[model samples]
Target: MAYARRLWEGYRELLASEEAYDPFLLLEAVEEWPVFVRALRRAASKNPAEALRLAKEVWREEVPLRVLGVRLPATKEAFLAQVGLA
Candidate 1:
């Protein structure tokens, strides 16, 4: 699985527990927000604080460093060489 997907799955799992999810605030959150996309549900089983922090992180507004994970093809010259075009 992709690292991002794994991270997100972990975040979801962590938030399911009472020790992590803020029922009060969670209920108030807008489901349509983009913040939901950044969530991660992973944490050490014994660390509730970190779990809550991760949840809050998913709730907050922050610019992401990555929007997509892609492996681009080689440069034009490399492609041409491979195809005998050079």
Candidate 2:
């Protein structure tokens, strides 16, 4: 545990030294959000059911919720609304 903690601290220091990278981008949710948005947008026109499925899958996952510190349904709905699919 100590070794892992030290490594994490070192990583944080390195990340802090770099101004271009937002550390939050390391989170799965933040990193994948844009891609998901684009995918959902494209899917919405061609396959609404598939887009809905993807949204539900993302909603059920814990990573985005943990990173965003938000709960289900509301968070999922907001994202869908942002893309104009809901």
Where model 1 places Cα greater than 4 Å from the true spot, the runs are: 1-45, 61-86
Screening candidate 2 with a backbone cut-off below 3 angstroms (N, C-alpha, C), the clashing residue pairs are none
Q: Candidates' TM-scores?
A: 0.23, 0.49
1-86 per-residue lDDT for model 2 (tens digits): 23323433443443346455454655643455455456566666677776676566555654534545433334666777754468
| lDDT tens digits, residue span 1-86, model 1 | 13334554544454454464555434433231233333322232334455445434433312221112111124534422322223
Q: Candidate 1 has what TM-score? A: 0.23
Q: Report the number of the highest-lDDT candidate.
A: 2
User: What's model 1's overall lDDT?
Assistant: 0.35
